[model samples]
Target: MTKITYVEPDGSRIEVEAENGSTVMENAIMNGVPGIVAECGGACTCATCHVYVDDAWTETVGGPSVMEEDMLDFAFDVRENSRLSCQIKVRDELDGLVVNVPTRQG
Candidate 1:
């Protein structure tokens, strides 16, 4: 299991053991982390699972896909580090991954 940390808008942090092969959004949903609505589930269509990858982890996490990038146009408070958590697959190397969810979704 990977240790994933999700920082809420109010600075609250929720860390959980992420299952490998699952998406970050799935981990958030399974752990009941606030702020990730995941309206479209893990389909990568609604962009409701938007999150901001910690600056230090961006390079390793990589960027969004073409569809994910287009869907992000509907996300609220989009940022340079913004990403669709559903597009991020969990792995052993991402043990210390950290992401921040916006206060609201689009």
Candidate 2:
């Protein structure tokens, strides 16, 4: 299992054991991490699962796909690091991954 950390807008942090091959959104939903409202589940059809990839891990996590970038247009407060958690696949390399949840989703 990979260790993924979700940081809430209020500064709260939730660390969970995410299985490799599963999307970050899945782990967040399974762990009941606040601020992740995956309205379309892991389909990547909506921006409800928007999150900011922590700066330190951006290079490791990489950028979103064109399709994901289009979907992110609807997310609130989109930024250089903004990413839909559903698009991030968990893996051993991301064992210490850290993502920040916005105050609200799209």
Candidate 3:
């Protein structure tokens, strides 16, 4: 299990032991973390699950794929570090990953 720390826009944190192979968005939605709507489930269609990965962990987590990149374009606060959490599969190598939930999802 990887420890994924999800930070909200207001600086609140919700840390969880995410299962391997499950996406960050899946964990967040299942754990009932607000701010991540995940309307399209784990499909890279809706950007409601948008998150900003901490720069320190970007390379470790890697960048999003073409489809995820396309969906992120529609996110509320699109940034260079913006990623659709659903596209990030959890792994032992990604332990302690930190992602910030966007202020809004639309």
Candidate 4:
């Protein structure tokens, strides 16, 4: 299992063990992490699962895909580090991944 940390807008942190091959948004929804509405589940059609990739993990996580970038247009307060958690697949290399949840969704 990969360990993922989600930091909430209120500065609270939620750590969860995520299974390999699952998406970050799935882990968040399964673990009941707040701030990720995931209105479209892991389909990557909605921007509700938006999150900010922690600065330290930015390069590791890489940039959003062109399709993802288009969907991000609907996200609130989009930032350089912003990403849709559903587009991030969990793997051993991301054992300690960290992402920040926005104050609100699109």
Q: Assess candidate 4 and give its lDDT.
A: 0.96
Candidate 4, position 2, lDDT: 97
TM per candidate: 0.97, 0.98, 0.96, 0.98
List residue ranges in candidate 4 displaced over 4 A: none
lDDT of 3 by residue, 1-106 (tens): 8999999989999999999999999999889999989888878888999999999899998988888888877898688899999899999988999999988985
Cα distance off (Å), candidate 1, residue 21 = 0.2
lDDT of 1 by residue, 1-106 (tens): 8999999999999999988999999999999998899988899889899999999999999998889899999999999999999999999889999999998988
lDDT (0 to 1) per candidate: 0.94, 0.96, 0.91, 0.96
Tell me which residue pairs clash in candidate 3.
none
Candidate 2, 1-103: lDDT as tens digits: 8999999999989999999999999999999999899999989898999999999999999999999999999999999999999999999999999999999
> Model 3 segments beyond 4 Å from truth?
none
Better of 2 and 3 by lDDT: 2
lDDT (10s digit) by residue, model 4, range 40-77: 98898999999999999999989999999999999999
- Lowest-lDDT window of 10 residues in candidate 2? 39-48
Candidate 1 local Cα displacement, residue 82, angstroms: 0.5
Whole-structure CA lDDT of model 2: 0.96
The TM-score obtained by model 2 is: 0.98
Error of 1 at 24 (Å): 0.4
